[model samples]
Each structure stands twice: as C-alpha cells, then as structure tokens.
Target: MRPSTDHPVDEPGWGPLARYVIAATLARTSDGGAVVAIVLMVNTSGGSGWLAGALGACITAPHLLGPFVARSLDTARDSRTVIAAASLAHGTTLAAAVLLYPHTHPAVTAVLLTISGLFGPLLTGGISSRLPAIAGPSQRRQRRAQGWDVATYGISGTVGPTLVAAVSAWASPATAALTLAAGCYIAAAVIRFLPYAPAPGKTADVPRPLRTLTGILASGPLRRTLYLTVTVAFSVAALPVTAVSSTHTLGVSAAAAGILTAAYGLGNLAGSAGVMIRPSHTEADRLTTHLAATVAATLLLITLTPSFPLAVTAYAAAGIANAYFFAATLAARNEYAPDNARGQIFVWVGALKITAGSAGTAAAGALISTSAALPLLLAVALTIASTLLSLAERRHNRRYNAPCGPASPHTQPENGRPHPTGPTDRIHDCSNRG
Candidate 1:
C-alpha cells in the first residue's frame, strides 16, 4: 500500500496548507484551553482539587487509545469524513461535559470527557498525517508545510491558555469551556473544506497494527526519531517547573517566571517562522540528530547560568532548538512512514511523548523541592543521551554498509526488491558521506 505517486491535475497550492494550519490551530487551541478551563470550572463549582485531577486524568488517559483510533482512520474509506466526525464528537462531548459537570454525577462527567479524549488524536496527529499528501510529492513543499504545521502548534500553545485565562477572569470558566468547544466546532467546519481526497483502494495485504508496530521498530530512521522525540518531550515538560524554581532561587518575583517561560515560547515562534521562510534542505533524520545536540548544549547553558537574565536567554536558545527539532520530527514522519501505517505512526509516537512528558512533569514536581537545577540537568543529560543514541545508530549503519534511507534493506519487500516510500533517489551509501 504505497502512497499514490501520481500528482493531481490541480495540485494544491498554499491555499490548502493555509486551511490546514487554520484547522489545526483551532483544534489545538481548544485542546490546550481545555486543561485550564476544566480546572477553573471544577474549582469555581465547589469541587475538590482532587476531583479536577480526576477529570484531567479522564482527558489524558484515553490518549493511550490513539493508535487504535488512528488505525480506524487509516483504514477508513473516507478519512476526511472520519476526521470531521471525530472533531464534531470531540466538541460535542466536551460541551456536554462542561454543561453536565455541575449537575450530573462525577462518573457521568468523566464518561463524557473520556469520550472526547478518545478522539483527541484526530485533532493532533491525525491532522499531521495528512500533510505529506496535502503538500504533494515535492520535498521542498513538504518541508515548508512541516514548518507551518509546527507554527500552528506554537501558536496554539501560546493562545489557548491565555485565551482561557482571560475569558475565565473576565467572564466565567463555564463560558471559557463553551468558547473552547466552539473553537473545536469551528475547526471541524473548516476541515470539511480542505482538499482531502477520498482514500485509495484498500490493498489486500494491509498490515495489521502489530505488524505496523514492528515495522516502526525495525526501521532505523523511525526508531531513532521516536527515541529522540520521547526524550526531548520528557525534557521539555520539566521547563515550567524549572522556570518557577529558578525564579525562587534568583530571588526574583514569582511573576518573573512567566517572563522566562514567555521568552522560550517567543523563541519557538521565531524559529518556526524562520523555517517557514527558509526550509532546511538537510535530510530529516540527520537534522533531528543535529537539533537534539543543539538542544542539549542550550540546556546545559541554562544550568550554568547564574543570573536570571542569562537563564532566560539560555531558555530561549533551547526553545529555538526545540522548534527545529519538532519540525525535523514531522519531516521524518512524512518521509519515512508507510502509507498504510502513517496515521498510527504519528498517533502512537504522540501517545508515547504524552506519557513521557507526564512522567517528566511528575518527576520534576517531586524533585523541585530539593534542587531547582536538577530537572534541567536531567533534561540536558537525557537529550545528550538521545543524541548519542542516534549517532551510534548512524555509526552502526555505516559499519554494516547499510543506509538509513527509505530504500534501506529494512524496508525491502519480501520479494527482495526495495520499496522506497519516500524521496530516496538522492540517497547513497553511508560510507560515501562526510
């Protein structure tokens, strides 16, 4: 089940990509806002803090189902229909949860929120999985699209929580929840107009979920990307805790923590914009490794900095590296994923990152009381480890005379012919490279 190599007569231009960014941004904004909105809603409604935590669990735990949900989308006859329906379901269920939380049983509210969470991947990875097709077979276009896709995430991360906080402060948490739900609904409406073609004919030998998982593990490029992604996610998740701790250590006002965090977020946005203007020509796998090293270095700088301003500068530098790292991750997915397993690859990787990030956050919380610098140092170590892992794999591939390109032997068909799924014509033996 290869992606169709034939180009459409009316090859989509930036129009479709713009719409995709809009839809993705809206969906992601709602997702980010939901956390703050739920906490505020529960707190204002006289619920215990633990109840809010329980409902947050309901939202997050269903992310484990992402791979299965993605499999359903991958096999659907009309992916657009499936995705749009999922979007609608996400919005409706969330709206219902917000409305019912005050009056209904806690169990009932949890059920509704869980249902919304079940469809969460459709808003994130499901949307991302379509980018390669939307950008056509042109690698340059795909790279540019990846940059914009990353930008949408950065924008949503900044806008969502701020939106929720403002609305909750001025109006009410219930109103904020409804507003977030409306954003989801709007995203669904926008998604329907995108240039998504109907799914191609099903292949007789479509890989099962387990087989797809095996393929992901066996493919060196993908395996390396996922490893690095999870490590980076874990490290980044500690930043918020680290920011607050650093402020306390520096004897600055706690409010300055927001300033430090905003520096990173702004740097991310700047980096994303730079990628959009000048997309990298380097191979995705190689770029990912380089960016990981850069992140490790920048994080190390943060740990070494004694002054708050210097720490903020280091954080911003790390954020820039992270932005490029994330863009490289998307490029790797677009370049290496099998057509039939693409959705699952994206969703499963996302699920893994979410799990790692949660663990990192919990770990940071537990360790922050001891040393403010501990989590940042841990992040630096983890990123360096991930970078070394990638470098070791590349070294192994070279020693074995194997290239990590799409046409690598690992991706060969059972008939012993290379079945390259991505642009690999330019790829050559690893030994021939610098």
Candidate 2:
C-alpha cells in the first residue's frame, strides 16, 4: 500500500497521540533509569561489583517473558487496565527493591527486581501495540506517531541515565530509584486518561500461543522484519563496549565513551524527528533493507577510522541508520501481522531482540580484549548477513509468485468477513497473503 499522504489537519487524533507519547516516554525513562540506579545503589551500599551485576541481570532477564505477558494484553477485554496494573506492579516492585536493599539478602532484592522486569514489556511493546488504534486508522498519522514513539526511545536513553547520575550525585542512588518509580506511577495514571478501546469481537476467541507462532512463521514479511530487527539489535548492543575500547585505543579517558554514546543518541533523535516530519513514502520492506545496508556501511567506516573524531561521526551516522531501520521494521509489523496476533507479534519480536542483545553484549565483552575493532567488525558482518537473508527471502517469494503485498481488489477477505474497502484495511489484506 502506498503511504498515506493525508494532511495534518485531516488527522484529528493528536490529543490521544500526545498523551500516549507522554506516558510512553515516562515509562521508558523509568525502565532505562532503573538499571543505573540499581547498580549504583548496590555499589554505594558496599555490595560487591559482582552483586551489582547480578542485580542488574535480575532486572533484564525477565524481559524474555514479554511475549507471554503481552498475550494477556492481546486477549484482554480492556488492555488499559492490564497495562495500568502492570505499570503499578513494576513501580511497586522497584520501590520495594530499593527500600529493602539494606535490610534484605541480595537474593531477595534480585527476586523483587525480577518481578519488576516481568512487567517491563507493557511499558514498551504493550504501549506500541496500541498505537494503531490511538492513531485512528490513518496510515500517515500512524507512521508519524511511530516516529514520535521512536523518538521517545532516543529521548529516554539520553535522559534516563543522566537523570539517575545527577540524582545519585546529589542525593543517593536509592533516591534515584524512587524518582524513576514515581515516573512509572505517573505513566500509569496518564494511561488511565488515554482514549482507547479494544476492537470489538477481536478477543472473543483467544488465540493459542502455538497459533500465534504459526502466524508469525507463515507471514514472510513479518518474519523477515523480525529477523532484521533482532540481528540489528544484537549488533548495536555491542556499541557501549566497543566505544569504551575504541576510546582507550585513541589514548582518551574511558569517560570519553559517554561522549560518543551521547553523540549516537542525539543522532537517533535527529533521525526520528526527520521521520516524524516526513514519513517515508517507500515500501517498508524495501526501506528496511536499504537502511540495514546503510547501517552496515557506517559500522564498517567506524572500523576503518583511526581518528577519534571520525569514529564519533561514524557512530552518529550509524545511529541515524539504525533509527530509520527500526521505524521501517515497525511499519512492516503493522503491515504483515495478523490483527488477532498483532500484540503478540510486537512483544515476541521485542523479547527476541532483548535476548539477542544480551548475547551480543556478552560476546563483545569476551572478545573486546582481543581488539577494539573486532566487535564492530562482527556487527558489520551480522547486519550484512541479515540484509542478504531478507533479499533471498524476497527473491524466493517472487519466484514462487507469492507476493507479500496487499491483496488484489478482486480478492476476497479471509473467513468471508466483510473487509473494509479502504486503505485502512490494507494491512489486514497483506496478512491474508500468508
């Protein structure tokens, strides 16, 4: 389907979209800040570095359960209630962890943080899955809203750690944790005011996990998009380690890593802003492949540059490509995911990316002592491989005459349901192609 060219004046859902962006940004900031706050809290409390690391892991590991948790959102009679409850639970657990750290065993604190992490996806993928409804069925508006959503990630990444650091420096790490928890509570309250409703009859027959998995596997575009997203996430997750090592090689203090990382985050915000101002007109699948190649090229440039300034520029450029790539991936999911399984697809893909990122971080930590350039090289190779895989899949589909685009006007909607004869239903028709 062609991208919507509807003017802003024609899109009257800005109020709800604004509320969503605000709530999502707050929740995301809490999620990102909590990690730093927890680590600092543990270290400043005379805990071992290993204990701090373990506590941080407790906050991240349960993100793998995102898909199952998101399934509840998909089938819920009212997703807002589920989302609000999850946010409250996440905040309560984080607060508990902070308050009990001095009085409880490290294992006990870890368990509390793990419970907090279990609801983390509701702040991310769960919020994202609702954008379609909130954006009110205009593809252009939805795309713009998505760009705003991407911007929140960039904003939170920069703001969250900085906020934690400032708070920890001024007051204490425990105070920082409490501040982030309060943000979560505010996000939950904002969610309560969002103008959203579940699609009628969409959840009447809850889909089995196996059925959702089958649907994901059957949709070629969705599968390819998820593959690209995971590969890119895995590659990008090594950036922090690589940046630190690269700065050391350039005879800079390890603290220079922060400057380089911040540059990338700023670049990400720029890219997202560009998308919001002018949503891409290109097909999402094609845009995703192009962006992936751009990312690989930028990473390769980083490896070739010996000058620190040039390296920083390369990192920023790579971030721009990554942002655009992520936006395209979101568009692909919107286009190819079955309506009944949309929430699950978003959450499942998010969970897989988190798992891949953890593995990538571990691999980079293991290999960075060998050479600063090694991790970046690995990233370049993985991104290129993912792009090639997507191209190969597209070629095979073409050879088999299995087009992944929207169904033809003459084609009938599945199950004899009366499909809307409008561009809004284009995604539904594309899913039927599977």
**Candidate 1 TM-score, true structure as reference:** 0.91
For model 2, residues 1-434, the per-residue Cα lDDT tens digits are 22112221233457777888888998989888899999999899888999999999888889988887787877877677788888899999999999998998888899999999999888887888877766655566767878998998888878899999999999999999999999999998888777655542456565766677677766667677888888888888888889998887777888999888887887798888888999886767677888888888988987888888987888898888888888887777765566677788878887787789899899999999999889989999999998998888776655444444654452244332222232222334454432
lDDT for 210 in candidate 1 is 71
Name the runs in model 1 displaced over 4 angstroms.
1-10, 198-204, 402-434
The CA lDDT of each predicted structure is 0.80, 0.79
lDDT by residue (1-434, candidate 1, tens digit) is 23233333135777778878989999989877787888889999889999999997888778777777777667776576677788888889989999988788999999999999888877888888877767766567778888899889889989998999999999999898889889888888877767655453374445666777777777777888899999998998898899888887777999999988998998898888878888898877788999989988988888788888898888788788889899999888766676677788888888887788888899889988989889988988988998998888777665555434444343344222123333232234343231
Deviation (Å) of 70 in candidate 1: 0.6
Q: What TM-score should be assigned to candidate 2?
A: 0.90
TM-score (all chains, Cα) for each model: 0.91, 0.90
In model 1, the Cα lDDT at residue 188 comes to 82
**Which residue pairs come into collision in candidate 2?**
none
Best model per TM-score: 1
Model 1 CA lDDT for position 175: 90
Instruction: Report the number of backbone clashes for model 1.
Output: 0
